[model samples]
Target: MKNCIIIGVAGGSGSGKTTVAKNLVKAFKSEDAVLVAQDAYYKELKEMSVQERAGVNFDHPNSIEFELLKKDLETLLKNQIIERPIYDFKTHSRKEETITIHPSKIIIVEGILLFAVPEIRDIFDVKIFVDTDADEMLLRRIERDIHERGRTFESVRDQYLKTVKPMYLEFCEPSKRYADIIIPRGGENKIAVNMVIAKLKRYLQKGAL
Candidate 1:
């Protein structure tokens, strides 16, 4: 099997990192690329009450099961299939089901805190940081959490003020310095996204992976 290319997409919540990741997958075709979300590896909170889990600072690096994520990524890089976990944001816990992920030519790992951890940062062949204004991100986040994550507007706003913004400022923003590419305006910046795609295609052509 040919070597796989691992791309890390990091940004604050609602920064459109997912858009960049999706565009990359679309660029390569889903058959050639697989997307892995770090949110799925949120440390299982089975031990905590729902209320307690809700209060947990998910934006922190300590909240992610990086060891498991590292193991799965290593397995994928070795051209092996692995069972990826599914996390339920509404319940703030893991689901029993897992999705099987096969090795692909490209793997896009997208997360808010991927770069906050050194071990996770070292595994990426390309590191991308999606930058967006905090106000814009907060708006997007509020909408997403309320509509999709079953969160109320008040709760989302409270969480943002209590933990999200603080964590982003402390961890996510600082991690931007490590990015090989910084995408402003998130995934909507077609020029930046295309540039990344072109670079990856060239690397594949050169068998760099």
Candidate 2:
């Protein structure tokens, strides 16, 4: 972790930020890099009823446990392993166990509200914003939530209208100004991704010098 580079990938839900982060990881050897998803840091809702948890505004910055997320990243930066939380999207709570993440030279943090929270955002060495059309975002969200996240179409659509779109306007969208790089055309923009990969390699190379 001696010259570790922390990259923040931020965007609206389903904006392809996770895809871009995965692309960055693909550019490096596994031992040299790791991906930390902000989705895993959602505040534990053990106290809430299932119905109440379902009503929670997941798109808001307050829904995430940013202090713990920052601390975990700081732990990794110190060349230590961390017991990363494992969240269950279906259950809307964290699992009893955690996964261990070893230190890496490159850390890619991907999430919708990543840049909106100052405590977490301030720690990033590079801030990347993935830009996509709102309509496309909604489409992708609907697809992913229903298939991958075990959410119903009605639930996904309702959440988007209730929290996702509004929260993006109030928090996530405005955060684009803090980005050092804005990647257009979503994650399929290989040229933009490659440019970033090249710069990241240079950063690691320079650290060796």
Candidate 3:
């Protein structure tokens, strides 16, 4: 069998990086493709109080369990299955159990800060950055966090205004230079998506699927 291909999709919060990654996974049509999200690696927060959790700057790179994540991905790349951590957004904690992931023909790792760390960045065959307007992203983040993450609108706005927005500018946006493709306007740009799909198809057929 051909070796699996690892693709990294990264962008600012609510910038549609996951949307694009999902579409790419579906386009592959092979059951051998797996989707892994960076959100799943949020540091275990069991002992921290609500006040302590609220004080966390989640947008920071240190907020993720990078060591564990890197080890898990390495196992997956070696054709071995691994238990992936499951993070609870509402509770701000890690679940007792993890989800199992089997070896796949393709791996799509999506995150807001995928390229921020050099260790994780080196493993990807393809790196994508979803570029979207700040105003639009903030609006989408507010709606998603309030509705899906069980967060108050005021808190969501506060977090975005304070940590999220600043981190995107200082950490996420600057990492765009490392991407193989810079997708403007995120998933709304079909041209960029189609191009990525085409390139991936070619790679898949070239004994690297």
Candidate 4:
């Protein structure tokens, strides 16, 4: 790729950023687009006990290794492959094995904190934010945690009240001002998704010419 474009997608947890990112990737050829998640670079909690790790505030920016994410993005942008870390949600730590991501023409990086952190945020060529209602976000989060993270309703609710909502208000919501595009109603908004895909295709076409 002569000109690789890095697109950053940000939104609160359960706000449909992941869905939007996935749909965006699906709109293009697999080789031309790839989606990377910021959660993959979560800070290693090996020193803490599993129980203790469960109590860690994952929604906070401190809990993520943005420097590593930045480095990996740089590597991919340089037309190099990266050994992307595999995070074990059950263990709340990184697994030994890493996934390999080859260079691609379009990179979509989705995370809650990307827009909140200047070091990582400033690197993106295009920034997107997905806006979803708080009630809807909480509901989606509850369902996701129960199914994916092996959490109970009580624990998920407690964590949402303790960290997720508060952190999102402080960090994620405020960062929306930085976004070049804001997709409301998330991936369910087909028109919004189509528009974004169209814009990206146009950009790539311009680069090819």
In order, what is each prediction's RMSD in angstroms?
A: 1.4, 1.5, 1.5, 1.4
User: Which lDDT tens digits does candidate 2 get at residues 108-199?
Assistant: 99998888888888999899999999999999999999999899999998898988999999999999999999998678999999999999
Clashing pairs in 1: none
Winner on lDDT between 2 and 4 is 4
Model 2 misplaced stretches (Cα beyond 4 Å): none
lDDT for 68 in candidate 4 is 97
Q: Over the full model, what C-alpha lDDT does candidate 2 score relative to the true structure?
A: 0.92
lDDT of 4: 0.93
Local error of candidate 2 at 11, Å? Answer: 0.3
What TM-score, computed on C-alpha atoms, does each candidate reach? 0.96, 0.97, 0.95, 0.97
Which consecutive 10 residues in model 2 have the weakest lDDT in total? 200-209
Tell me which of candidates 3 and 4 scores higher on lDDT: 4
As a whole number from 0 to 100, the lDDT of residue 203 in candidate 3 is 79
After superposition, which runs of candidate 1 have C-alpha atoms over 4 Å from their true positions? none
Instruction: Please give the distance, in angstroms, between residue 197's alpha carbon in candidate 2 and its true position after superposition.
Output: 0.6
Whole-model lDDT per candidate = 0.93, 0.92, 0.90, 0.93
lDDT of 1 by residue, 1-209 (tens): 35779999999999999999999988886667899999999999889999999999898889999999999999999999999999999899989999999999899999999999999999998899999999999999998999999899999999999999999999999999999999998988999999988988887778774
